[model samples]
Target chain A: MTIRDEHLRQALQHAPDRLSAPHENTSRAVLSYARQTLEKEQRVWWQSCMMWLKKPLVSNWQRAGVGGLATALVVMLIFWQMAPEKATWPDAFPEHAFNTDKNNAVALMKDKNAAELNAPLMRRKARATGAPAQEQTMATQPGHVIGQGEHQSIALDHSSPATNEIASAPISAPAVVAGANDSSGAMSSANQARGSGSQKTEAASAELSEAKPVKKDAVLDIMQLLDSIKNEGGQTVAARDISLSKLRMLKLDMSTTKQENSAPCLQMATVDASPDMETGYPVLMVSICDSSMQLINGVAEYNQQMQDYWYRQLQKKNNER
Target chain B: MGESITTDEDLMRKFCAGDMRAFELLYQRHERPIYRYIRRLMGGAFNAQADDVFQDVWIRLIDARLQWQPRENASFKTWLYTLAHHRTIDILRKSGREVSVDEGWLDDEPGSPWQSWPAAHALEPEQQVFWRKAGQRLLHCLDGLPAMQRAAFLLHHEDGLSVDEMRLVLNAEFEAIKSRLRYALFKLRACMGAYLPPMVD
Candidate 1:
């Protein structure tokens, strides 16, 4: 290096030696400032968490829990509202429902002995005529018992005068003697004569004998049940679960049973149809009654067109017979 | 109190890893030279701006410890001076002052080299007073040089940076850094010789 360059470098290098250093206070302050800044950065995580928790109303987690609970409650309420109502006693055993006897009658005729078949018809006819007839008390019998004193005859004293008049009607020997093969024909003839008002009482007894058995037997069985309870000093029957199958069996038993003529009870009338033997046209027999199981009404006349149709069918059936 | 035998880059790495003691060692090693560089670059710590710029450079160094690594071509000292140089220029510009080194300003009053040469002698009180006066005059002349020249001169002469290192710190081409240093030396020699001439050999 040149003398001038060497001297200039030496002078500039030595010049800084005379200048002042930074104050101790400023060095400490800058270091302290940096530490504070870094310390703040370090705490950012937990500080942010605390900030989130300080939010109004509730935290996000609690809102999720409450939302879940609300959704569950809504689902439960929807299912509850949509669920079916339990069947009430009256609905379970309605006062008037389609009697299933029509469906079972064919089975009964095919299954039972001729004696078993004739017994129910004879008892039903006897009760319908209101003669001094015996009622079968055995529960196995598909017929209702009429209790009167120590004997099993129904007492006619509690009945209205009209009922007493019915009870006092004479039983025709021809009706009592008709074979099961001729019963339906005899019943039809008696019904036709009654339509003319000449044989009303006699014909009504025959037709009603068929009508009252199903519903009246059920009512009488319930009455017989209540009577047994009364005989045991009227203790309340304990509640029990009646299964649907057992209920259906009770319904079948009630429907197949014959009803004796006695006190008033709930009644259900059924229609039976058969093809005329010769004409092969449908013949419909409809039994009519009031709610009291009393034969106060009758299906005397159909449409005039139907009467001619039915008369042709009946005459053809009689000729075939 | 013991000067750390570790290199500046190693100290910086240690500081980045949270060894504050290594940072303090690095600070103590470079603080005086950096403070002087900024002090002379802004005329002195007499101006509050010079102090502000001085502290800013050190704080930047501390703050940048985590990001600092010694590259193949650049030393920690180059990086340190680069930070100080940039901060000085920023303060100077923000204060609305231009940094101009008038190389011709010395030519206007050129005295022959021997006219102000002090006699060669063993170190004496009279020679010390003359050198002290000469040193004060050189510092005053440094203040008048252009900002880039003063920075180049200080990085070269005071911080002992090579021309290539100055290029890195000053962010100028190597030749530009050389020219700035050459011009700075020329002016300081002229200015100081006019005030107190060295004895001619």
Candidate 2:
């Protein structure tokens, strides 16, 4: 074994070293064969991906077009959800939305007196024709049990309809239209105040009781995100963090720069400097003039310096005279 | 080398976008490593069956269009070895079912038994024949290793997959891959009596 090992080492070194690595013809042939097979089979494999076209969740048509449509739909839906609500200035404000409602809501905010709180919840009581007025009035106010009974009755009667259920369960809470003095009346009144412009609004109203003001941290987070976006995306500085007051106070005589229907939009030709001068900050919409930006304070100081230079030159001439 | 489909991933990317010639380009590029890997894998096992399997491994790769998503975890090399390992296991697991645990050569410098042998410059042709015979014996010793270990050691030595890739190929744990490699080297050293003498002088 020792001699054999020694010889093995010698053979490796002595074998003329083959001048180069193997020609690798077989390797090439096998790989080429594989390539051909792959090319041939790729068609079938790609077909499997599309074979089940009927599944709505996984359709090539859906992937090619429906995915886009679904994405667009989701985006539009999010936009619709995020869109600033168009307030329908009601032709006439509903009677329920009178100042009385606001006052009542604020007053009953902490009031636990059921009777006093329920005062706003008066509803037209069902009565037989020609019933005595006194009886009808008494019937409307059944002290406590009748009110509880009415709640139970409403809950039983108006609960959501159970359809196609194994058991026709009268289980869920009914859509009970509360009477005038009900707490829910105030809630529904609140919902009405914030008009359900769309289903999202209605859903939002349902969640109104649980809603809280936007968190300061969340606002800070959003602002930070926007700042990073600006930094990374090279957005115009004028778009964010520019205190509008600083620019509006420029005291720029409109005639100095005014040419066309140019306003304060951030375009160049729109807010260009005249042959003499134009005093405007870097309105992005405005043309880039020497660094293309200025603050009102900076501009004012620049103007003062220019005036001083002229005045000094005039003073020197007078002294020479 | 015949109409090959040799595209490196970088090349495949160009080809994926309706480049017919891209496929052939990639085949030509990867032809050697892939061929050697298969050739070495099914050494004597190379019959009609192995020919089909070897060809299929390439076909499998091509069909995978795996070049599309060259993932971080499933690397191109790992994926290729993964296919190769599975096929080797399928071929060999039929009889000598014991899993061999290769103990050395996992992650270190190359130290084959041939390293310790006398330099060929000193040897004549007759001595060269003895060295050749010894090399053949080393292969026999390699054959004693577990099917996957032999395959892993050979693949790593020849094909140059990373240790992590070996883990993927073997579907074994990282420590296990390391030890398997260590064991293979230690055994090879023992088998090569010249390198690892039984009674040191």
Candidates' C-alpha lDDT: 0.48, 0.40
DockQ of each: 0.19, 0.07
Looking at model 2, residue A214 earns an lDDT score of 25
**Which lDDT tens digits does candidate 1 get at residues B37-84?**
888887643356666787788778767766787799888988988898
Q: What digit string (tens of lDDT, one per residue) describes model 2 on residues A1-321?
A: 011223223322332321222245544665566556545546775466555555566844445453444554564345336533222212111223211221121011111243333332322221312334553343334332222222222221112221111011111111111111112332332223223233433332334223322222211222222233323332232222222211211112212122222221111111111111221221111111112123323433433333334344445665686
**Model 1's DockQ?**
0.19
Weakest ten-residue segment in model 2 chain A by summed lDDT:
A265-274
Compared with the true structure, model 1 gives a TM-score of: 0.46
State the fraction of real interface contacts model 2 keeps.
0.11
Task: Give me the runs in candidate 1 sitting further than 4 Å from their true place.
Answer: A1-4, A13-19, A37-321, B1-3, B44-46, B100-108, B194-201
Give RMSD to native, each candidate.
Answer: 29.9, 26.8
Estimate, for each residue in A1-321, the C-alpha lDDT of model 1 and write its tens digit: 221355666555445356567788877876675565455556778686665657785755555444544664564356336533331313322222222233212101111233354455445545665545433322114322222121112211213443233223321111100111113332343233223221323343344345434322222332332233323322221111011101100000122112222211122211112222322322222111121121111111111222334345445665686
The candidate maximizing DockQ is 1
TM-score of chain B of each: 0.88, 0.70
TM-score of chain A of each: 0.16, 0.20
